[model samples]
Target: MRVSVVIAAYNAQGYIAEAIESVLGQTVPPDEVIVIDDGSTDGTRSVLERFAGRIVALTQGNSGQAVAVNQGLALARGELIGFCDADDLWTARKQELQLARLERDGELDAVFGKVQQFVSPDVPEQQRARLTPAVEIMPGELKQCMLIRRDALMRIGAFDETLPATFFIAWLGRAKQGGLKTAHVDDIVVRRRLHPGNGGRLHTEAQNLQTLMALRKAIKAQRPPE
Candidate 1:
């Protein structure tokens, strides 16, 4: 199956190249790579230009991740779709392994693998010393770790553009409620870079509230009519 990889970037000049490089270097390269630049004021656009012909680079007004992702989804032309955060790296065998598992099981709508977290090597020694992730590696059910069929994704529908911090969480909740079949592998597929500018770290309060709201919405969707 043709696989399309999507990346949503905003002010990721420092690490976006590495993220794209990792995907390009995968053992089984994606059929297409789509990157949506969310109106970054930094050198992110310049960095994207470096990979001009290799990627389908799109620029848009300062929209949030959800909007950028939705835009990519609309333009994607693949049977299977995957995502990689602008600051994260995919292992060289990520696509190869995940695609194998997906093709082996016709009933599985999606497949995910483990994720390894690490501080960016570019972080200063003092800054790295101050930051520590609770878990180095764990089973990742996040978008970055998933390889899903396009039809399945369409059934779940577009992500909620309103929930900036928790859109994926809300979408995942809805997918589960819709009985999306999924599977997990033991191998590490993604390396999540933890940095000072991480959205979750920078917007803790908003994320917390949004997480609660996503859960409530999921519960309400499952209830009978009043």
Candidate 2:
């Protein structure tokens, strides 16, 4: 199965190259790598230009991560859709293991694994003190940690653009609602950087409110009928 990896970047000049290189280094290389620039004013565009034909580059106004991801999703043409954050690194066997497990479990719709969050120059010493070895999503929560079937993603419908900070939760909720048969892999799929510039670390009040609203929506949907 061909895997299309989509990366949503916004002013990620410092780490974007590393992220792209990690994907390129994958043992089972992806069929295509699509990068959504998201109107970055920094050297992000210049860096992307250097890659040239190596990646499919698309640029839009500074909307948000949700929009950028959706744009890539809309343009994706692979049988399976994968995602990578602009600042995170992927394991070399992320796709190989993912596809192998997928081939093994023919009934599964998606598979996700844990993240290794290590100390980085971007992370402050104080925050590093409380670092954890692994970051796993809760039983009912959804994260873009694995490869999803392209048809399944399209069936889930568009991501909630209003939920800029937490639209992923909503999108995952949609996948679950669509009866997505998901599995948790034991391997490390991603290396999450805990730098000061991490977008989730800098959630504005507005984005936080959107996140809360999205959570409420998910909770409401999951509730049993009265």
* Top candidate, metric lDDT: 1
Global lDDT of each model?
0.96, 0.82
lDDT tens string, model 1, 148-195?
A: 999999999999998988999999999999999999988999999998
Residue pairs of candidate 2 with colliding backbone atoms: none
lDDT over C-alpha atoms for residue 199 of model 2: 61
Tens digits of per-residue lDDT for model 2, 1-226: 8889999999989899989989989999999999999999999999888889889999999999889999998888899988888888888988888888988988888888877776567666687665433543332123447788787777788788888788887788767776989887788888877676766666567667877898788888888999
- For each candidate, what TM-score against the reference? 0.98, 0.88
Q: What is the lDDT of residue 164 in candidate 2?
A: 78
Query: Ten consecutive residues with minimal summed lDDT in candidate 1?
Result: 123-132
Off by over 4 Å in 1: none
- The local lDDT score (0 to 100) that residue 98 gets in candidate 1 is 92
lDDT of 2 at 135: 45
